[model samples]
Target chain A: MRLDLFAMALAVGLATWAFRYGPTRLNLSNMAPDSLLNRFLNATGPAAIATLFVASVLPYLEQAGGHEIPLALGTLAVLGGFAWRRSVVIATLCGAVVFGLASALV
Target chain B: MSAPADAPVTATPQPMGFRDGLTAALPIIVGYFPIAFSFGVSATRAGLTGGEAVMLSVVIYAGAAQFLALALVTSGAPLLVSAVTLIAMNLRHLLYGPALLRRAGKEASTRQAWAWAFGLTDEVFGAALGALARGKRFSEPMMFGLGLGAYAAWVSGTAVGALAGGGALAAYPALDAGLGFMLPALFLALLLSVLSRVQIPTIAVAAVATIAGTVWIDGTAGILCGMVAGALTGVLRRPHAS
Candidate 1:
C-alpha cells in the first residue's frame, strides 16, 4: 500500500533518526565487500537501466513503424552526441533537429 | 614537473565546499531545464491541470519515473501497476546506494544519508559515483548541493513548461512527434555514459535480454525481466566489480 506523502516523509524521518542514534545501526564502511549479492545488485543498475530504455522503445520498434529509420538514426546520433559532449539538453536538441528533418524526408 | 610525480598524496580528501559542488552541478542544472520543461508541457496537454503538473514534479521528483506515471495515469492504468513500475524502474537506485555509502563510509551521518537518499537520482548518482570512482573524495555536502541544484531546475522548469508551453504545444504536432523520442534518446545517452563503469559481458547480456524480452512482454515488465535475466547472468559471470 502506498503511504500518503506526509506519512512517507514521517517514515523517512524516523528511519533516519533510528539509523543515526538508535540501537540498530548500519555500518556502511565495509558493507559486504565483493560479496555475491553485492555484485549482482551492482550489475543490475546498468543492466536494468539499459533494459528499461530498450523496453521503452521496443513497442514502437516491434510494429511496422512508419518513421522507423529516422527515429533510429536520430536516437543513435543523440547517444553519440551525449557521449561526446556529456550534456543531455544539447544532445537531445541537436538530435531533435535531425529527427525532425529525417521525418520530413520520409 | 607536476608537484613531483612520486610525491606522497594526501591521505584524506579535502572537503568539497558548497561552492565547488554547486559549480559541479551547474551543467546538470542547465541540462535538466529543457527536459523538465518538456515534461511540464506534456503533462498539461495530457489533461493534468497546471497545478497538478507542478505538484507531481515536486512530489515525484523522479525524472523518467514521473513521465511513466503520467503516461500510466493518462492511460487509466491501475494504481498498483504505476507504483510497481516506478519501483521497478528505481531498483537501480539500490545499486547506487551501496557504492555511494561505501564511498561515504563512516563519514556519512544518518541525517546525511537520509537526505542523500531523498535526492539520489540516476544523474546525481552517475555524477557523484563517477567522481568517487575517479578518486575524488565523497562529501555529503557536495552531493546535497548537487541534488538541490537539480531539484530546483526540475521544479521550476516544470512550472514554466506547464504554464507556458502547456497550451501552446497543442498546435505543434511536429514538436510532439520529435519530443516522443526525447526520453528514449536520453536513456540511450545515459546507458552509454554509464558503460565505462560496467563490464562488457554484463551489458551484452542485458542488451540481448532486454531486446528479447521487450518483443515478448509489455511495457516496463519487459525491462524488469531483462534486468533479472542480466543479474542472473552476473551471478554466472561472478560479477565484475568496478
Candidate 2:
C-alpha cells in the first residue's frame, strides 16, 4: 500500500470524526430556534428530490452505454415500489434486484 | 431575578424510534451502496491495493468528491490543489450542519451534533429532514442507525468492487459497465419524484447554466455555479406558495 494513500485516508477519517462528533460535545444543537428547525425540515425534501434528479438522470442521457435498458427497468421498479408501498427500502431493493437480474440476462 | 425558579420542564415528543430512523435512512443506504461500489472499482483501476480502497471508503467517505479528488491526485495535481478543490466541493456540508441543528437540537448535544455533522451526506440530511417534516422528533439512535448502516454498506460495497475488479473482472466484465448507469438512473427517479413545474424549470436553468460555465471556466466551478443558480431560484420561488 502506498504510504501517501494511507496518510490521506487517516486525515480524512480524523476530519470526519471531528465534524460528526464535535458539535454535540459543544451543545450547539440547543442554540437553534424552533422556527429555524421547521424551515430546515421543509427544505430537506425538495433538496433531496433535486439531488436525486441530478445524480440519476443527467449521466444516463449524456453518456451512451449498453446498460441503458437495465438502468431504465431498475429505475421503474424502484418508482413502482415507492408508489405501491411508500417504503424507501422496498423501492431501493426493487431497483437493485432489477438491475442485477437484467444485467445477468443481458 | 423575577422569573420562577421551579418552572416545570415540558417533555419533548420523541419522533419515531430508532427503528423508523433506520427504515427512513434505507433509501440513502441503498443509494450509497452502488456509488461506493463504483468508487472501489475506480480505485482498483487507479492501481490502489484492496486495503487502500477499503480505507478510502472508511476514511474519506465523501463519494463524489472523493472520486474527483482521487482522479486529481493520481493525475499528479499538487496536494494543495487537490485539498483546496475537495474542501470547495464539500462546502455544502456547512449548510447541512446549520440546517440539522435547527431540528434535532432538543435531543442532540454538542458531541452528538458533531457526530451527526460528520455523517451528514445529502441523503442523510434529506432523511432526517423528511422525518421531522412529519413532526417526528429527531432521535440520536435513529441518526446513528442511519449513519452506521450507510457506513457499513459503503465499506462493504467498496470491498466487493475491489475484489471484483482485481480478478472477478474477467468473469463479470459487465458488472463495471452496469454499475456506471446506477447513479444517473437513481438521480432520474429522484428528480421525477421532486420535480414540480417551478422546481423542474429552475433545475433545468441551473443545469444549463452550469454546463455553459463549465465550457468557459472548467472543473468544479460548474458545480458551484449550478448551486448558486438553484439557490437563487429557490429564494425567488419561495413566495409563490407551495
Model 2 CAPRI quality: incorrect
Off by over 4 Å in 1: A1-34, A62-66, A86-94, A104-106, B1-14, B101-111, B129-138, B165-167, B170-174, B196-217, B236-242
Clashes found in each candidate (C-alpha, N, C closer than 3 A): 0, 23
lDDT of each: 0.66, 0.60
Pairs that collide in candidate 1 are: none
Error of 2 at B148 (Å): 2.1
The residue ranges of model 2 lying beyond 4 angstroms of the native Cα positions read A1-106, B1-35, B70-85, B95-101, B104-111, B130-136, B186-202, B213-242
Model 2 lDDT tens row, B112-167 = 55464567665677778777777667766777777777777888988988886744
Window of ten residues with lowest summed lDDT in model 2 chain B = B181-190
RMSD of model 2 against the true structure: 7.9
TM-score of chain A of each: 0.56, 0.54
Q: TM-score for candidate 2, please give it.
A: 0.61
> What interface RMSD does each of the candidate structures achieve?
5.6, 5.8
